[model samples]
Target chain A: MSASSERWPLRKLIFDTLFFAYGVALFADALGAMGVSAFHFTQDDFIQNFSHYATFSLLLTGVMAIVALVANLRGWTTPGDALFASPLRKLELSARPWSRSPWLWQVVIVFTLTIVVSVRVTESSIGDLLDADGLQGAWRLWSGLSQPNFNLLPRALALAAETIFIAFLSTVLAIPAAFFLAFFAAKNLMQGPLALAVYAVLRALLNLSRSIEPLIWALIFTVWVGVGPFAGMLALTVHSIASLIKYYSEIIESVSDGPIDGIRSTGANAIQTVWYAVVPQIVLPYIAMTVYRWDTNVRMATVIGLVGGGGIGTLLIQYQGQALWPEVGCIVLVIAVIVWLMDTASAYVREALK
Target chain B: MSASGSPLLNVRSLGKTYPNGTKALSDVSFSVDAGEFLVVIGLSGSGKTTLLRCLNRLVDPSYGEIDFAGRRIETLQGAEVRSVRQDMAMIFQQFNLVPRLSALTNVLTGQLAHQPTWKSLLGLHSSTEREAALEFLKLVGIADKARVRCDQLSGGQQQRVAIARALYQKPKLLLADEPVASLDPATSHSVMDYLRKANRELGITVICNLHYLSLVREYATRVIALKEGRLVFEGRPEEIDRAWFQRIYGEEARDVGIQ
Candidate 1:
């Protein structure tokens, strides 16, 4: 074995210790839950609810603990497949896959144990998905969805139009705002203290705003602008500016310097230099990004109405709350068609630009 | 343009030490009479490019005075500095014309410093200026390539466009920073011939950096040598004998002919 594999690897040791601690805690909690101790990790109910996966994980944890202890005491590593290799290989040589890559096998076992333990802790189950009562409820929902209410078609179509317009208006509003702000945000163009200060502040603002989801922006705009498609448009516009500015600024930052030097060497002033050298190289890229942003905005516009920004989502949540599955289906279908069209159109436009 | 007995350009104690402590040029002093073809000979990083750039204020000299047309221009700032650059056109090793712009547009850029603010801002050159730019393109033998983007042109063609752009500026001093360094030997001679033509016909004082001593001998009226950022030799082109070449380029450096 190589020295690296022989030594107690830092990553493996850390992982084993952390997982061993979890096993110890689980055992302590279960022992305490039996009323032999005053405190426990949770209630006695948790002990009862612990699945077979946890018990199996506990046994694997015991095996790992023993192996780690032996390895540390003897200045060895992996002790893994090679230790159990003879017996397992005798049964089936290649079938015992760890014979090829012991570390991969170790990682797979650890990750599997972690996933099973997490699934049990979260109380997630296949049982709910297979239950008679749940299946009946799903059947009812499906039947209603299959038979969409045509009586609400006109209203749903109108709301769909409003959703698309909100996306369109916001994307249009964002273009000039983002285009101008991008120049200021680009580190290359922003020279001197005052310009650099603006660059720093604009970067912070863009980063802060971009991390927040458009849905959250919609919620805020609902309160500020009084629940309507206008609020949704404002929300999308704000988010688009943050996103477009980052993309646009990166594009501006990477522009070829040869042309910039050429223009500047000719004694062109600041604005003329950028106009002649920078802008020509950037126009096609900017147009492509705008199309891409519009496509994203269209997808977001359909969902922003749940909080009060009027659109298809407003109708979706309302109908869902009232158990009007057919009406909800109609709105979802409208959203799907518009989002699909925008996706296709933007892809085509961007490809043409390229 | 030799107006009087005084030299067209004079430098005294010129030096530039970059912020990173690279002493690119130091104590470099020389004078260029109007219409003289002066070539600067140095090994790579001997500060030949830095010296030419300093004359046009492309790279600010850390300390020195640059006297141009009987006026001190080293301390001149802002628009005045640009006016000085307008009279000292530069050609680069990489032929730094905007690759996406038409050859005509690239040539027109040379006149931008003298253009009205609104006119240049809108990229609207007057017909006379456009005609003059085309005339320069014709002069450089690339008139047919006026509408072609510079990036589409061959290496030799691109350098020709660069020379045309500099010629259109009609500068008193033409600064060519190893203008043939990136070109093939055949193209190298062609480019050097253009520089020589500009010197003789236009009466433009030329300060060129050259790598090949062969080209320097053929084209240069006078030559200056720099070693480790200090001027080591200043004389006629023929003065660079074999022993001097060994001293300038270092012993064990054999002179090889290019074309």
Candidate 2:
């Protein structure tokens, strides 16, 4: 017998215990529905309305049990033997039968359950989504967008400029800090256990900082700096610097060993070796990474402003809350245009550098 | 050989055993007089590299005494070792030029041990150093390509640039680790010819690791053969014959001539 067969009995025992516990809980709930329980644990309303789907659930459960048993029997049967014994052998697909991929039916069941649960939890109705009331609301938003408020154009431009500036300043602040930290974080530079320890600590710090979103960081900073562009910049700087360290250190680690060897053979000091050999290799990629971070920061800066960290996002949130769809449309348009321009420009620069 | 006052390098009982327990070299005792083209030959992993690196203390010998220019080398550390290294230069099989850098900048980097850190970092080399770099590039016959990025050059040209870089250091001794291993036969000859010029004209003591027996015979003034990290033979290149080849390599290894 296979090694897994030894564990099968134990697994079967665990499954049986779980099934018995579930049955006991269901029976207890049924008694509670009849007001027979001392704890007064009420049954869910779902069971009272079970008449609607009882027949369907019973048939589904029975079929699922049979399918599960067949799938479990797969471990004991070889594909060739199962195929030879199968009545479906003439169909040609039975050469391997169900033995080769016993998990397929389980996957289908899980997927279907997920969809059913999601539909119930979300209370989503496809008919409601396509109804006239929803279509009318969508049309109103579209109509407002088509006739964006030109009067707020100048204000939108100013806020957009401020948002871009915050991103630029934060990215600029992040660059040098990330560049310095990367030396400590890069595995190639971690020569000894102590250096590796330093790398691990620095890596953990970066990961910790990166795990908190820029918006959340902005909320924290807004409390500290009292709500301004500086607070937003601080948030972006902290988040971007950590992320940039991860990118920059990876690039440093991947630099070809040839140049490092050549440089080291010159009797250059550690600093000189890194300056001459490693920096030259990673400079282009570092710049590209920084510019890419700046693009993301610009988008994030706009978002962070919703929490009172001074930018166009503050105005977008205000206009949205006030139901001034026309003003919101103008601000969004301006942001879209600027983001598109930055993306195109950075792409060109990266392409040229490459 | 010239009857020099003293051998330029004196090495005795040099050996290296890696942390993982691979013995790279053992009981390796050798010396080199100035202006000798010494070629080390062996099958791969036979410790020719470990031997060459030991001279400059690049790969520190676990047990050895190395006297270079009358100073104990293996005992030196940090700045002292660096100061000794400033007098020696190395070229590699891969050429090792910064691929994104202009050829001239790559050549100028050889002066890194001598120049102040900011000078090279800022690309502000003195006119004399810049002139010397260009002259070295001219010596390797790649003066016109000084402004070109190293990655854009052919393998031969890149190796030539590497030679120029090493030469620009004005090092008294040059260590070349399989410097022509990656090139075509003709290109190999071209690179080796520049190395020869450096020895003859610059009076730089040369030590190199080589694979091709023919190249060893053609270029080496003195030859040392390694078999399984042990020094098996040391003599003039002409002394290595069919039997010696079988011993240095293996009984079954035929001499594969590259033309």
Candidate 3:
């Protein structure tokens, strides 16, 4: 017997209870479906349907159970000496048989055949695949290359510029604000009830801003700022503050306590400690995170513009509504290029900072 | 102010109790004359570090006064404290040079108190200060690695850079807290040698906390020992024999407490 079995009969008891409960539930459901009035069945019609399905399910279940039992019994086990060796050595010793186990091959064959049969059952005709209502149209929608139009270039460029501008302006404004909030949030810097209160407020504000997606924020800002890049910028700014506060606080927490302790030991005041020590340690990571946030905001700006917040998404939406597939394709291409460029530039700047 | 004659640092009955209610130092009294090389030795948690930090008011004492150069540091506030810090320097066991900064820049940071915050932020050190920093780096024998980032240096080299930074401050007192505790045997001697040279040549009072009894005997002119946050021994290096150390360390101090 295994160590677990020798130690307690708890495992056997649990297994027996579960097995009995499962069988009882299964039998009760079957009888109830057969119009057993004592358990409340609506009609005897269920008896005919239940009998057919239950017989089929029973055959399938029995075959699966026997296969599982055979597979478990046939699996390989290492010798006692090998099993008791250091974990790494034991792993190496046991790996060969484990890999070559017959059940592994059986499982692979079963999975492959299941997929093949599924594909055959679900397969559609090539004519239907090529039809405008089917796979061909879906492919065109995905690639945006089946029909290409260059006429939307100017509008797309303008919207892309708007997206970049909004992201840049908002991120710039959010950085310093996040810095202050993060300082208050850091436990080493601020202590006591007042600090805790400030932390709670900042956390709530972060959650509130992030909870309402940027698109929703854009809609709200559109009402306030009258629907332009300005509204988009405002929305992105609020969202960036929420995101950056979390990132900046984590960065502040990871900063080396040495410099902070050194400053405090010098009898420097609290503000001085933050200015001299905390700021120095976090400066590089802060700049890197700010650049990353700007890149993410640019991507979000495009999505926000679908609701008239002013970006490439606006141009794409216009073409889409007009059924000008080629024009929409052109707009999407421009957006992709802009996003890729921003991502590459962000990576380059991050590397330089490191 | 001439660095002469008078004791550079004076501590009278200093006591510190942490917020968690652990008493770090109690009734500690010590004074170092100008240019004296004082080394404090004790087992771990014996408040040797607490005493040294109390001199610079780094870890503020809960009760008592520390007077450095006739000014009571424990009572100093704001700019007064900054002024005092400008006049004193500390070296850490970890050689806490800003790892991302060049060795020269680390040394320049020592002069930050003298400059406007704007200048320090912009890294606009005066040309004279820059030259002096290089000169001090040469004194510590790492001038060639001036432009190298601190992380690239070996432990001993990093400690040397730390010493150079403290030297650039032109401090009246250099408080080193177990400066060589993290270093290997060979490197520890070199670091101690530089500290001794600074003490003898520049008349800088070098007060250090050391774990090694042999190193303390070789380096320090005056030795101070503590046990459980109280002053237990104060005498010349020759007077700190096996019996005196036994009294200071007791049964708990085995390999660490004896020479």
Candidate 4:
């Protein structure tokens, strides 16, 4: 990500020329727009390009400049002992004869204007945030939430248990799958063309699965499996596999090569070396990640049930649809308890391991 | 032991060109005799590590023959290569002990290749194997500290455990890749003394790569100097005078003797 500008003089020149042309064109256009002095430039629209070529030329020239900068920083550029070494001696913007103000002031104005424009485009209104009627409706919902609903308590407790189980099962299934895939996905483990190919394929598959949210996966699985906790667990499983693979593989890649090499030197073959050296180092971390993923999966499972994928959310949504706030309150309490318990359990397990 | 007394290891025109096109070593050849403490000395990036790696087939030589213990190592592959590696134990500059593991467990790793694959993976060593590993820890004078995690151990203690691990391999040759490079001056000598003990008492051939000429002169029965991937000198340590030292490690280089 670093380069020497000296290495690619031509690229630097191209970048300089484009940037210089843009500044000059803008300056000249501004002068003409103001009907000022001897700068006889004309413009149909204020912002539209009188020199549109300058903007487009920037795309290529900017890339070249970055490449040169990176090369220079990386020490790739050597001292040129040839002809045509003469580049622009100094590139000072303040020294430009036509410059009326510092570039920093212009940049500040541009950024401020961009934020102002964004605010207008988004149509945000602070005045509407605390509207009287909405406040009245919020009071009703708040009053209902405050009241107890012991009638739905038994059902809510069952749903809470089911939700936690869904998370547990999904994470349990994902762990072994992720554990195996991580070895293949790790850069250090993947040697030779075939292994690299497998790595790329596995990485692509993981990325594809991980990109979609568990809610979306739940929706698809709900359609396939027909609206149940089974669909929710399946959705969580897919996401956990991808997430765990990423976590596990990165840890695997970052493991100290010293111990691995030491084991290898002892004449352990590739499998033996990994089994003996790599496993011991990574096992503790892998267990921690498994617990972490299960925690995440539980959070995801709660949301998945909002789409009729089971748990207390399904019961809460059903009651809320009928405007049954007392029943909804019961389900919400159950969910809070479930989450707190999971958080405590995972933390305790992690602390105990250490 | 090779009673015939031919060189335990030999190299003929060993050369290595890495994938990125850096020639780490070129046309370098040397042989290690049985029961001799040989030292390889050079500045960093002078192919010392690469040479040790090649001897164990951790990195294969690009061309030329490596004859080790009468075995043609340069041509070795797969199981053949792995089996041959067991005979040559290597201790590294970093100590390379698995920090999280206990010192005893790290030493047990030295016997990983010698035992059944399933047993090593399960870490289910026999009581006899455990006793032998304990004996190695005792040899390195850290038997009392066997159950302590390697990361908790001092730098010198960790290195002693590393030496114990190497000795546990019961190897024909001990390849020390700047074994004391990471240690303090006092600890460096202590570690070197263990290597000397392994060579003198245990009769293990030691091919140690070192930076300090003082350590080389003190320990080495024979010495080989590598400069820019080529063997520049191969003679007795005392023969390397101030003039010869300049020739081996360029004129600008001064030997920073470690006390």
Fraction of true contacts retained by every candidate, in order, equals: 0.49, 0.65, 0.17, 0.74
* Candidate 3 structure, TM-score to reference: 0.71
- Taking the tens digit of each residue's C-alpha lDDT, what string does model 4 give over B42-144? 8899999999999998898899898788778888888788778888999999988888889998988887776777776677978888899999999888899
Q: For every model in order, what is the number of clashing pairs? A: 0, 0, 0, 9
- Candidate 2 CAPRI level: medium
Of candidates 3 and 2, the better by TM-score: 2
> Which candidate number would show the highest lDDT if scored against the true structure?
1
> Please, what are the lDDT tens digits per residue for candidate 1 over residues B59-138?
88999998999889988888887888888888888998888789999999988888877888788987999999999999
DockQ, Cα level, model 3: 0.23
List the lowest-lDDT window of 10 residues for candidate 3 chain B: B250-259
lDDT values of the candidates?
0.84, 0.82, 0.77, 0.82
Residue pairs clashing in model 3 are: none
Ten contiguous residues minimizing lDDT sum, candidate 4 chain A: A76-85
User: What residue pairs are clashing in model 4?
Assistant: A2-A70, A2-A71, A3-A69, A3-A70, A3-A71, A3-A72, A3-A73, A4-A71, A4-A72
Residue range A1-354, candidate 1, lDDT tens digits: 345644545555545554555545555545554567643445465477577547756776777677566665664424243343344333553454664755455556556656655665677879998999999999999988888887888998889888888888999999999988999999999988999999999999999999999999998998898998999999999999999999899999989887777677777777778888898889888999988998888778878888778888788889999999988777777788888988999999999998
Error of 3 at B80 (Å): 2.6
Sort the candidates on DockQ, descending order: 4, 2, 1, 3
Model 4 ranges with Cα > 4 A deviation: A1-123, A344-354, B1-6
